[model samples]
Target: MRLLAVLDRVDTAPFTLEALAGLLNRLGPAQSRILHVAPSRDPDYLSPDEGMPDAAEHARFEHTVSAQTDTLRQIAQEWTQAVIPHRDTAWTERVGDTRTLVAREAAGADITVLSRPSPQDNAAVAEAFAGALYDAGAAVLIAPLEHYATLGLRPVVAWHPSHTLDLALQAARPILERASHVTFVIGENAPMEVPDPPLGAELARQGVAVHMDRFLLDTGDIGEQVRQHALSAGGDLLVMGAYTRPHFIEWLFGGPTQDILAHGTLPILTRHAPLVRL
Candidate 1:
């Protein structure tokens, strides 16, 4: 599989660069495109009525952009030099609207990796993430500030009834097949028919260690519940569907996917928007 690991910003956790490279190596031998994207230059990004930055602000921003671009280049070059003689590993800095660049770059990628939204994220950071899910035409593997474990080791799948869930499972099949253990966290409202095809049986046929159980999620605190449950279960990765319906639905009522995105700690593997078939 060809993977696109987008380091949407350079100013995340300091060790994030290392963590990103570690994950690249962890995804077996898949060809990877590592992109460290520059912040957007769109004047209307934050506010529609806002005009272009004044000369002073523009100068400062340009300086910051130059520095960030250098940092990204250095990090990628150093890592590339260290891993000399490797094939199918490319890294570069992309400058444009974060949303448009990420979406366009993710077109044929088998999966895209990105950092989780931090509490300190500004508007651009948040929008880039949402764009990766909604416009990438691929699945996303969300990474935390720190590396917890490999991509699929002891994976925890949040199961429900939807085409979204099915797509998530299929996209995650490669990782699931290599998992040390797999736990199916079924929500209370989850359809009983989800197990009709017997998801466990399907995985078990491929020799994956699988187990299933129901989780009573406190509707208001679903994020907290998911985190606690995954931690208690010794989960290293949390897999689930991204905003399954139209993005508008998630904006209106919110959903487990958004909640988990907001609060989840484990590396999450999920797919949504223009769902890509695996």
Candidate 2:
């Protein structure tokens, strides 16, 4: 499997980098593509509405960006070596409006990995992650800030029999098929007995040893519910479908996906595609 791991600054210095390295180990020798998106000079970057200065400022900024890309390329190689040691990897840099590029590039990726976005995170990182998750046409795994030695070793699936869950399960098969222990936490939306063949049967067909339980308390607090259940069940990773409502709607009222991203204690695997977010 291959992953498009987008870096906000491509600097592998933070706990974010360490966390990514840990998640990479969990995937078991997969190819990695590193895409760096940031202003070359600083953490803060001005968007178009913020206004730009003269031609000199523009040229200088472009040069700085080019220089940073070179630096990031070197860093990508060095970090991957120190982290994964012997994994196939490639590196690239993106500047300016990268939404379309991220979507196109992530089309063939099994998963698009990004550092979990925080309220304090740069606006650029938030924009990139939003675009990637909404448009990548694949699952996106938001890596936590804490470094983990391994992920997906013991996994919990927050499941409800639906198209979204099916897509999520399909995307997570690589991890599911390899998990030592797998638990399925049936969310509030799930019927007592799935109408069609149970999801557990499908997972069984894929050779996943699994069990299920009900998750009904604190239904509004999806993140806590998933977190408590998974950790209690000894899971290292949490798998669930991505944003189902329009991104604007979710951002406005917040949703389960948003709650999980904000407070969940584990790495989250989410799948959404071709979002028509307004």
Candidate 3:
């Protein structure tokens, strides 16, 4: 699968490069593009009391935007130099509006990888990118800040009977194909009704080493149990479906899906889907 990674600056967190490289290795040396998005200047810089001619303001705004674009181009060049020597990977950097640039770069890509930004600095960029890619029907891999470098081939699938499971698995197919081992953790409180076993059989056919375990806990912390199981199994990646229940249900019941999204430290592959019925 072709992988696109969005990088602005060098990541300071440990293992970030390692994780990215590991993921790239699994994808088998496809073209990797690093898109650098530049911030646009505000055209509303004129004083409210002053009535400036429309044409003059437009010309000034264009000049400022052009200068900013040039600066971003230089930054992109420097970024390319820093990343090129570190790996045997192709790198390219383009500067433009982040939203539009990302969409263009991701157009034909099968998957995109994004590093989670610090909470303070434009955190919405990553989130917005994730949603845009998801809407575009591209698989997105979000690397967490803490464990970016240590993700290996060992993975744990957080299974449920919902349709989200299928989408999540499909999005993670590249990793699953390369995984040395995969464990499916079934929560104890998950509906007593089990899902169709065909998916398990299909995974086995793909040569995945699959194991199923029943998670049991009386403390009502299914999220904790899932994390513990993944860690115990030596899994570096957690594969699970994204939000499954309705908004109100999630608000009232506190779904395990939300809990994992908020608390899980491992790299997660998630896909949105409708609820699956037996």
Best by TM-score: 1
In TM-score terms, candidate 3 sits at 0.68
Candidate 1 lDDT over 120-215, as tens digits, reads 655566556666678765677777767554556788887766676677777788777777688887656554534533777878888888877566
Error of 3 at 10 (Å): 4.5
**Candidate 2's residue-wise lDDT over 90-130, tens digit each?**
88766556566676777778888777665655556666665
lDDT of 2: 0.68
List pairs with backbone clashes in candidate 3.
15-149, 19-149
Cα lDDT tens digits, model 3, 45-69, are 4356655548877677678656644
lDDT of 1: 0.67
Order by lDDT, highest first: 2, 1, 3
Which of the two, 1 or 2, has more TM-score? 1
Model 2 has how many clashing residue pairs? 0
lDDT of 1 at 35: 78
What candidate 3 gets wrong by more than 4 Å, as runs, is 8-16, 41-96, 123-127, 147-152, 190-197, 205-207, 217-221, 244-258, 273-278
Which one is best on lDDT?
A: 2
